[model samples]
Target: MSDLFDLIIPPNPPREVMADGAMLLRGAALPYETDILTAIQTIATRSPFRHMVTPGGYVMSVAMTNCGAAGWVTDRTGYRYDALDPESGQPWPVMPASFLDLAVSAATEAGYPDFMPDACLINRYEPGARLSLHQDKNERDFANPIVSVSLGLPATFQFGGLKRNDPVRKFALRHGDVAVWGGPSRLRYHGVPKLKDGEHGTVGRMRLNLTFRGAL
Candidate 1:
């Protein structure tokens, strides 16, 4: 009788995966993908994407822009969050409602509720572009979680321990996936490996990543 009852019950829905303190909310952002893309299009029109130069004078391979109260910028001076766009000399576009709502929802689902992000860094990657492992320590506080949403082409995300030389775990992040990390994993080193050649129907041969954080 009990076995028959079990057979009739449906299986549980997908749940978030935990790696260290990081939470991988698979497919959590799918419902908002269209809206997010639309918001990106509007933001790009205001502040076009560009490859920012590092303080060391090397240009980043990934084209990046931001939408929120603060935008991340890198140059000879160093990497820091500024209220104004260095390129246009105007304030970065406001964070879209869809972007902010998705971020908050993902964070809450990952057990970090009330996660209000004041900055959303948008990264565009074409074939062969890659980001080296680095820690996000520029933020004013580590208490807030970092919420990253993946869209378009799939890519391998390299998540490492606190140390730069620590071994990394590569996770395949697909469109509409969201990864959240905070608390113990707040300062962990992470990055994306070189994107392989691929064609995404809506986005073409590229990938877009939205990383939301609380920055003063």
Candidate 2:
């Protein structure tokens, strides 16, 4: 496996440490690009998109939705995880096989096998959009790792530590990239910098991020 990986993704970037608990695996999901993009398109139709209000009373810059048994949400109350989509008062759209397969395969490739994610957050960022650094602490199981896939235009990912003021590492994530971290890195803070103006043939002037997790 070591030899195979070296041959495939030669010179895997330094495993850049972003914080005490965060690391970046660049282009980790390039091998499964097609399946991930198809999955995103399939789920978008059912759940659609909407800008969610943050707890701070400001609306998020990105449009978001979810698929799977649980979904991540933000509103006047604050950010949290829920089993149903607040918009329709129904369960978030089911996780497509394509999505699940790609996620598991990516996770497995990252040394995490048999990963079963029950929540998949789909975030779309247009030019000038950004996400604040925050921890993914809403899941019932902190033991489960996070598998995040990037598509469309590239964006700089800001990975931080457990605290807000912690130093952060920026990763320029492009289409077909996957980032996976867990164990000691599960609670690290992360976000995306403002997306630059650009357009892709399929996703247009936007970047899509699919984050898979096990939300009780």
Candidate 3:
């Protein structure tokens, strides 16, 4: 004897989904998405996002910026974390409290408590922009988990095995989804495919990703 509305609604609440050692917290960031976006704008104002060139002398399609004690950067010297912005010659903008809280909360929910990320990398992806499969190993420690939050346009996330050639599983990452990876799967290859054409009210034709890491 259930009502019509009850019959159409899901009985259980959304929960975290595990992929190997990685955990996907669906819709976990929805509540703080607006705040996160505001923080991004503020951070961008201090440190404008720009497309960085790889050591191989190729310009990246994804424009990126960072905020925290340490920021990831690349150039002829290769990938590494720096305290000062190479572009501005000043220290990277401070990590927003909202960004830190969301990252810590997501990691805690994924079973890694007391997570403190020293770096928050913000990546902006537009239509036709993509990131190839790669591991997050630039950090000094592999024990710390990487928490990534997604906002705006939907994109297909590729989570692969330890090796680049290993089989990959595609996950549709929508707005407000948070993905955490550590432990045994810390070195697994992961990347996003080319974004499709779409216009989100807030982000327009772009997808913003916040990846928190312990880079010190």
Compared with the true structure, all predictions reach lDDT values of: 0.92, 0.82, 0.91
lDDT of prediction 2: 0.82
Over 4 Å off in model 2, which ranges? 1-23
Residues 1-216, candidate 3, lDDT per residue (tens digit)? 578768898553356555656899888888898898998999898889999999999899999999999999999889999999889999999998888889999999888896899999999999999999999999999989999999999999999989999999888899998999999889999999999989988778899999999999
Alpha-carbon deviation at 24 in model 1, angstroms: 0.6
Q: Report the lDDT tens digits of candidate 2 across residue range 1-216.
A: 999998988785444444433445666666666776776677777777899998888989999999999999999998888988898888888998878887887677666786799999999999999988988888888777898988899999888777889888778888877788787878888899889999888678899899999988
Winner on lDDT (2 vs 3): 3
Off by over 4 Å in 3: 1-13
Superposition error at 109 for model 2 (Å)? 2.8
TM-score (C-alpha, index-matched) for candidate 3: 0.93
- How much does candidate 1 score in TM-score? 0.93
Candidate 1 local accuracy as lDDT? 0.92
How does each model score on TM-score?
A: 0.93, 0.86, 0.93
- Clashes (backbone N, CA, C under 3 Å), per candidate, total 0, 0, 0
User: What is the alpha-carbon lDDT for the whole of candidate 3?
Assistant: 0.91
Off by over 4 Å in 1: 1-13
lDDT of 2 at 144: 79
